[model samples]
Target: METKNITGLTEFILTGLTHQPEWQVPLFLLFWMIYLITIVGNFGLIALICNDPHLHIPMYLFLGNLAFVDTWLSSTVTPKMLLNFFAMSKECKIQFFSFAICVTTECFLLATMAFDRYVAICKPLLYPVIMTNRLCIWLLVLSFLGGLFHAIIHNAFLLRLTFCNSIIVHHFYCDIIPLFKISCTDPTINFLMVFIFAGSIQTFTISIVLVSYTLVLFTILKKKSLQGIRKAFSTCGAHLLSVSLYYGPLLFMYVLPGSAQENDQNMMDSLFYTVIIPFLSPIIYSLRNKKVIDSLTKMLKRNV
Candidate 1:
């Protein structure tokens, strides 16, 4: 028994979104359709950003990053998740790390985008100088680096602990909190690490976004340019929607540990952020931004 415990867990059985077999086909088809839309929308966003000369601004650049991140984020988890709908219990430890990296990167990207909008709206005259090519490049690099550091810290802590049995993971995708709950070790330190990282990241990013938008709002209210205010709302409004969708479920799941939360409810909340948000972001952005709409219209005409 001692030797059996010493071997540690190499693999895990993911119970997936549901334990009932009857729901398999319905969920698979549902996720498959959403995945398809996510792919098309994000790719269309990236392509529009690249092809349109008008979109060669800091705003679009960040949108391109968001689209790219969405593309990879959905791809990283959706394919495997779809497979699991039909495939039997399989090892997913490594994929869990990949998901973590993408989520961290995404958080930073959204915050950076808010900063871009703030500069554009609040400092219209100095926007060009403030968000120059060099600064944009640096900001993008920082966003990726922030994610890398986040993923490393999480893996570093988790790596130190050992698992002796292949346990069932409750959530559909790999999330830090749920994973921590099942760790064979004490996980006390890991739980603390989750709060330190998740709290700091979520709080810092949300603060930046809220502060930027608040400034923009205050500045716009004073301005007499009705057109200017309209444009600001069009762009910033979409961003706020995306931000809310991404963070709302996230806060519910991870801002604080709640033992009272049902595991199924937790998984549903995670699903909204992970799977649903990616599908909706592009639609919300394209609908709100006239430039994106014009670009789509032009492309459609050209193809026709």
Candidate 2:
């Protein structure tokens, strides 16, 4: 029997989205457009938040951080995915850290935004005091640090794995599950870390969002006026939308075992979490939130 202990594998051949040659060019065009739009929209959001004095509050501050992360996350994954789309053999390899950091950061940041929303709605009178400028800055710093810490731990364990057996990764990016599938040695420790951090941490964040929303929901329900309900939903609708777009696919991808995701579905899920969500998040905020729309309109009109 061939020993699986050999550890000299320096590269991996990513299977990308499909084996069908006919689909590559069309898919490339699609993602390329999506990437361009995401870049434009997210950067515009960050700049708008920074420049508009009325928008410089806790919510927008959190949103600016979200926008910045979304911009980089999309940039990090999509460009590389686009590059693979045109590769003649549908083969490419990328650093494991890029996907790790981007996804991990976004997870913590989303949770932090949930907390921000919680302060705004659940404790409306104390919202300003609770989410003060100093606290907001610290929260942002914590989100970044938490994400980097998760990514470092994840990649550190991953770096120890010997992938002497399979160099063909059956997915788009260097996602945790995909790497696990190809690892030659026993991935017990790696799996355990993911179980503890990815599973526990993701669950903890999702719970925070859910619990916060539950309080907001009860508050909205107690109000007899329909307008009060409308107001509540409007305040949180974009957030909920972005959360669903983010957590739905994220839970699907990471929560399950690696083998559960077949190649095609894995690629599509990667495309959604890495590419589509980043694009959709800004649009969700800008189109649905009146303040952002008003701010953007003024800026555009001024430019004109």
Q: lDDT per residue, candidate 2, 1-304, as tens digits?
A: 7756646444666666767789989988988999999999899899999999999898898899889988888887777677776562222223556666667777777888888887787788998889898998898888888777887887677668887656777766656777777787789888778877878778988898898888888888888999878978998999988888888777777665554657778778778878889899888998889999999899989999
Best by TM-score: 1
Report lDDT (CA) for all predictions: 0.83, 0.79
Clashing pairs in 2: none
TM-score of each: 0.95, 0.92
List where candidate 1 sits over 4 angstroms from the true fold: 1-3, 6-10
- Please give the lDDT score for candidate 1: 0.83
Candidate 1 lDDT by residue in tens digits, 190-217: 8778778888999999999999999999
